[model samples]
Target: MIVSTNDGQFDQLIDDLSRLPTYTIGRATTNSIVVANGKISGQHARLIQCTPTCFIFEDLSSKNGSFVNEVRIARKVVDKQDTLRLADTTFDIDTLLALLKAEPVKAEKPVPPVSITPKLLSEVESNSLNFTEEFADLKQVYEQYPKLRKDCRNREKMIRTGSVILSSIVSISAVVSTGGAALPLLHVLSGAGLSVLIPTLCSTLLSTEEKLEVIDKEYRERYRCPNPACRDPFGTREWELLAQQKTCRRCQAIWVQ
Candidate 1:
């Protein structure tokens, strides 16, 4: 469906199709799209049909990956009629077609489909993408550790309060016995139940131990080696100092945290 071509011109040519189920832009002659432009790879990228009205633009991991507006994405879900860019090309999906063109692809080795999750709150919009990660060391030093400690205290307080109420019941039932064959037995049973229950409740109601949390926010934003290739965590926090200036233990990235 060679709707348009604008490999090089004053500006890009526009393809106004409503949606496209599947298509690719590549320099390879076998590719559905034959982009002869030198800027694009021989086998660049393609759009996979996820549903009748949904699609995923997948980068084939070329020298330069395809861009949704300007952001580079390995894979991302998109709704019908969305447009994207690869090198100098811009494409509009064609959803109005009754049946999309299908072909059986054979290869030396199979390429796995890229996993892309669509945003439910809003339709996929191009221009930019934001990702979040985590660092537990930063969380423990600055934020969550205080809250976790407070929770431990609250749980201990609840156990103490519950123990006092149960103790009162046990003391009354053990000493103040009503006289009768059933009454004495009932008192004994009540005392015995409390003896087992109070300890059980205190021990198992909630864990009093601190749990280790994992790193999760944007990993690069945390105190770590600034080198994009390194994963070494920045070491040795100065307890008396409040400033963020620090050095990476592995890559020696001397920068403010």
Candidate 2:
């Protein structure tokens, strides 16, 4: 049975589900049951005795999230005892059965069995046996302190070089303008001041080894997993853990790091 939140387009949702061939259970039509506030609204659980062996519930992409039992479920199949939450309403198995009670049972033909070829089965087995291990090398690379230190040094050097260039320009201008002057010394004084200021400004602009260390520390702290299932938090050390990891130690949840 397809169920969704009654967000003004109830008729449209019913129409869409009714069009599907799998929806026909006995002679019951789409209008056999009605949905209200995410629940069955008026039916009893005994009605589900006439329900088809298999049923599908589409989310209809409601505004609020959907939950099966207490866990949030993405678009997928559901089973008995699963409680669905749509917006603010909750529909348990009993509620679903109750709603189905109002609909008349219709005769349905048995579905044909699907067959799989030997070639397809072999292909699936072959593909399933192969597992990629690219992330292992990547993890080792990130663990190396030398690479991180070198990166930090390179960044610091670039900033220092820019500072030196700005200071040199200021110093040269000061020397040239003050070559023979004592009275009109303001230009030289200004240039000398600028030379120191420029270097200081460049140094301030560039990130040093100490700053990078701090950034790394903060990143590790933020990304670290306190959960036992996902102990190794630094799965993707690239740019705040961008890579994917097959397993999380603290949570044991496989995900892209």
Candidate 3:
């Protein structure tokens, strides 16, 4: 059996769950199934396979909690037929199994060994030009960070605005439904509950933090040393300074044409 989700990073990975009787699911990389969504807790949930087909799913007191087929569950018996949800990501267990079973396995092609030879002058220059091009690409990706950050902020702002508008409408509807017959205290409490609860729930359900994380991950992947051998991550370092240096510190690769 395999455990997987239709979430980022883990989408293409097919990790066998039968290898371990128990498996953890969370945002942390150390988890058996890492889910990078913002709504997922670092140690969100655990799955235990008691038998070949029987499994137990338990929530680790996560903020959002776990749901099986749309019903919130603290602990429940689940199998391949059941669908599991963690935060915004949902996993169709049966679909995953079917996908894996239907996939055709391809045999690995063996690579032939290449004979070592001295680098020619033209080859050396060609590599330098390639590195320069790669460096320029990295700079372009680095420049996109500011816009990505702004987009994340804008999305969060939109969600907040929508939540407020929706919550206000729900509160007004609740109070109007009372037809002014209820006590003043009852009206105040009901309105407060509707407004606060609706917005809070909406905010939790539609968070932009996951999108921000994905942007950061992609930036780090793209903004790195041009040298393939030493792809050292220059975390949040100034791109202008890197360009001025003209060479990679780790690999001493030329970053200029």
Candidate 4:
């Protein structure tokens, strides 16, 4: 289960909710999930385990009320995929369960601080520089390269959409602020300045070609054989083709399923 805290951050992770037959969610200390938000009543809601894969959400007549997919409900049968809201905080049950099933992260030891001179920094940089364009496992490339491509596409789309919205807002605001009224010279100058700034900001935003160039650079940096010792660039090679090949040309790393 996932719980949103009082600070409006949904960082709390409950690995499993099935452990308990019934779990209470409220602002009170005795509840299973004690959310300290004012919207939540002292005894807000409870989840009663009905079956292995099903649970019943019972709202305790909260002031702000409980919701299942935005509809306020007193009692409802909920599955993992249901969207649950207790007062103001909302959480996806499927997302929470998915997070629980995801691979656990290993704890890392803290690294000690290092005091470095220019010579030491130079030596460190030289030692850390990887000449080979390969990883130790082809699986890494198979998994990560597609995600990189998707991220690039998403970023490009976001930038384009944002640029349009930003330019439109600036243009509209500049027009609306004037309101056809005879403004002071300073106000007119300010409006003119905003007009000048609109194009400048729009021009600064990366074009599709520039975004593609960045993507290409990123692709060159990362789309290599999954062998740290011999990272050969798989230039313009389709992932399917690489998978069919089964092994890296440079590193001989097996691309096992």
Alpha-carbon deviation at 134 in model 2, angstroms: 52
Name model 4 segments beyond 4 Å from true.
Answer: 1-20, 94-257
lDDT of model 1, residue 220: 19
lDDT score at residue 165, model 2, on the 0-100 scale: 32
lDDT of 3 by residue, 101-167 (tens): 1247698899998665566655766665358867776664666466544544454453443344333
* TM-scores, one per candidate: 0.28, 0.23, 0.38, 0.30
Which segments of model 2 are wrong by more than 4 Å? 1-32, 38-54, 101-257
Kindly give the number of clashing pairs for every candidate. Answer: 13, 21, 0, 7
Indicate the worst ten consecutive residues by lDDT in candidate 3.
Answer: 9-18
Please report, as a residue range, the 10-residue window in candidate 2 with the lowest summed lDDT.
Answer: 44-53
Q: Write the residue-wise lDDT of candidate 1 on 60-94 in tens digits.
A: 88786777756777766554445666776665555
Residue 125 displacement (Å), model 3: 11
Q: Which is the winner by lDDT between candidate 3 and candidate 4?
A: 3
Candidates 2 and 3 compared: the better one by lDDT is 3
lDDT of 3 at 106: 97
lDDT (Cα, tens digit) per residue for candidate 4, span 1-257? 11222322111111021122456778888876677798899989887543233456789989999999999998876766679998889976543234222367899999999999999999976555332222323334444344434433454343343333334323323322222211221233222212111111122223334434433444454567655676688776776677777666665666533
Q: Tell me, by lDDT, which candidate is best.
A: 3
Better of 3 and 4 by TM-score: 3
Residue 122 lDDT, candidate 1, scale 0-100: 45
Off by over 4 Å in 1: 1-24, 95-257
Give the TM-score (vs. native) of candidate 3: 0.38
The 0-to-1 C-alpha lDDT of every candidate, in the order given, reads 0.41, 0.36, 0.55, 0.50
Model 4 root mean square deviation, Cα atoms: 25.5
